[model samples]
Target: MPDRAPQPVDRQLPTDEARDLISLVRDIAQREIAPKAAEEEDAGRFPREVFTLLSESGLLGLPYDSEYGGGDQPYEVYLQVLEELAAARLTVGLGVSVHSLACHALANYGTKEQQAEHLPDMLGGGLLGAYCLSEPASGSDAASLRTKAVRGDGGSWALTGTKAWITHGGIADFCTVLARTGGEGARGITAFLVPGDAEGLSAAAPEKKMGMKGSPTAQVHFDGVRISDDRRIGEEGQGFAIALSALDSGRLGIAACAVGVAQAALDEAVAYATGREQFGRPIADFQGLRFMLADMATRIEAGRALYLTAARLRDAQRPFARQAAMAKLFCTDTAMQVTIDAVQVLGGYGYTADFPVERYMREAKVLQIVEGTNQIQRMVIARHLAGPESR
Candidate 1:
């Protein structure tokens, strides 16, 4: 095969339409989200009213097809909306990202009947969703999950196991649950659309997470929960692939959220430097502080570019797992670094909840862990390079 021409650098600069989304996001984030962020985060409360507002504004389904009640916007536009939301409140931004992840199984792998039954509630209303894949025994090695779903009388299956670290575990109306059906390893896995209110299904008390507090995380326990065979997404052995695919898209959302947090950190750093005077002059007037701000801005720009490039590949129906991993790893790490520097720039003030930079710093740390940790991302990238023999 001949070598292909190098693909053009995927850019993510705002278009006319993207600008309109940005304007709308800014207005809602400022007028609605920002004011409530502290109250909700402190109380570990989910922002139901804010989510209702997002649904009403058509911001919840920005990347899905318009025929499905989505905003019909491109991933680039959707990501910017997430970034703006993250800049205002990490809780809501992550909640949106998790909902999109939950929607992925139905959107990409669901049969016509499943999509018709599920997509509208997920893509149109204020309803939230949870993607249930991780379990107590499985995290990075998801193929090793032991959640079992044995066929029962008639055409039903009884699912039994615990799904750990589920976002929106208790609050979501629905979940895309992955469970084993046939044998060991990934091929035995199957994805099931389990209702939150299903019999024998219960959510544990929320975990006391270190950050992104308002976004509820808990363990979902299924003790012989019955689901119809029709609820299975794709074939019986396709759950692993579907879960991976959903995480691939979910990673891009996390990357966008990271960019938003980093952007917020950069803005806060600039504002503080310009306001806090030292040596009879604003700190921002110093070349040292100015260089740091420049670096933070540059990092955010590069992270944005990588995520958009990967998202374009996804939108165009191209192979993008490696690219998605790259974006998630780079952008999340950049968010951590930039937020740390933002705190450093403020000295003592940045360490307190009195300033938003401290909250942003705490929030950025989790981006590195969720939607496949950065370490897992590097493994995915390396496997792509190590050839077919590696896996």
Candidate 2:
């Protein structure tokens, strides 16, 4: 399909200001992000300057308190912004989500002094951040993470172990890490804020992925990386809780991104069908192709609504974990199906690198696995309904 402007999404905004914010984001996305997306992803280049611009525009911390550098926008509004950015480029949108996840620990649980000291820089000081919770041996079973942090004689601690599948691993300015502070199991883990340039901290090469090549995914090693006691976030045993809380919100971000991808694919399919002719007429005139496009658009709309509902629940300060997981599961599955259908609509051209639909398909696959797999999401939802599984 030929490149075209983003299709308009009718949104329910809480205020005129929110609508204005979306317009600004769309302008930035069109002018700065969408055009270079394919080229940068092909070259496996992360657009650091784009992030700097986002920081400068106050787009990096949309959902946090404005007392810091956050935009103080609600999740409902913030997620729509994410959708706009992701429609332009997943690397940028997903990167913002991960950065918000990294800041969650300190922003929510850190002392006031810590917040005043660190939150501003993270929100808009142009510093990127990463979250470290998963180890090679403990991806889904995060409680079993083996990374250790031993208390020193004074008020410092030294961490040692490897965290896997870290987004922006090599490029982050700081990391919010979960490590063992006591005995085995979840209760022993603690969260810490460690500078990227900490002694003995290093990142291995980025993983060779099928898509999202522009965003690096790699293993980060903490070899006796030391941090002051002041860097500790929340209680010693509260790290797992903090991690789960962050993921609850992070899942909504993924859902928004999934919708963005699906929307882009649908737009491409519609554009291609309306232009590409067969049997002496545009394929869009055929009922079979028209129905496919209709279904694609319908699914995208439902997925967008589903995610927005979850985001709204979160903004209301209510119990939203079940809804968040539901959104993550439903929206990501919709993206996968919709993108695949988009490929079918384009026939042969869709399967090749010549189009972005193929890339959207590859990128959609990962959303099902991250922030708790679809299986895990079902488990979470089931637990919410039927209570925890009996041992």
Candidate 3:
């Protein structure tokens, strides 16, 4: 059977404008993104044009400053948009999240001159971005990254490093990169806005993955890529703090995406159950399948609430890191379980390439591992609850 279009979720949006925004997103998702998702994903084709469309539609900069070509929406509204996009396609949702992350350092910490110079183009000028912090040796221990940026004549900086698992690596129009400028740890790092086509910058072939093949993940190599000091964001020693700030919000994005995937899977399962009959009645008529569907719906609802709570706190400019970590942890784990149960609900059909649940299952696995692993999220939460772990 053909996959059904996911039903529109009833959301508690903040305003009429937010409701209209969501309606528009659902229309776009159904019309533009969902139809080609399976085919393009199977072919490992990245939807660069879709991102272009998003930029043109002002969807790319929804949570940024209106003065600099952004939509100026709050995180509460912005994350719902993410959930809708993710329900259509994880690649698009996560790509937007990463692009927003790439823009965070400059948006929050750049001088007025810097913001006026670059923010407009970055926020809405059809330019896609990548965040560069993870290195070959540093994933969870981001502060220990070893990418080097050394000062040169004429106040230029030459960056040399390999950044691993960078989404949109080769295709990005710009990258927000963190590299060492002083000593060996977090305090030595600095952020720079590097043009993707810079002289010595290059990306390796994309990684082969279990799912979301439509999204490229590659290693970015900066072989003495030179940029003027004007490209620097924040103080020389403030990059780590900036990166952490971005992650707190980025975690909320992941949580929203997780809920979206789970919602999609549950929708698929329920649709299938209602349509597919067994023993002269629909399987959904059976108590066992009904219970599973109910549980899946419940979990998805809980995940959505958790992420939204975190987003609200962030929108209010309150301390939300602990809640963000908890949201990422709970929502992603829920996605993993919901997708698994969704597959079980579909029985043998779920295991096949013919269905999207199998793909969703694979995609959900990575959410637990990315942004920060769920294990790392637990460590973060523990530190918040008690004191920092003893050395």
Ranking by lDDT: 3, 2, 1
- Steric clash pairs (candidate 2): none
| Candidate 1: tens digits of C-alpha lDDT, residues 1-391 | 1111111223344577767677777888877887777767877888888889888888888888777778888776787678778877888888888888888888889888878877888888767789999998899899999889999899899999999999998888899999999898989999999988999999999999878888889999999999999998899999999998888889999999999888878877887899999999999999988999999989999998899899888878899999999999999999999999999999998898877777888889989999888999998999899855432
Best by lDDT: 3
**Candidate 2 lDDT trough over 10 residues, lowest sum:** 1-10
Candidate 3 lDDT (Cα, 0 to 1): 0.93
Q: Stretches of candidate 1 above 4 Å error?
A: 1-16, 388-391
Clashing pairs in 3: none
User: Number of clashes in every candidate structure?
Assistant: 0, 0, 0
> What is the TM-score of candidate 1?
0.94
Q: Give the worst 10-residue stretch by lDDT in candidate 1.
A: 1-10
Provide TM-scores for the models. Answer: 0.94, 0.98, 0.99
Tens-place lDDT digits, model 2, residues 218-303 = 99999999899999999989999999999999999999999998898898999899999999999999999899999988988899
Reference-based lDDT, residue 18, model 1? 69
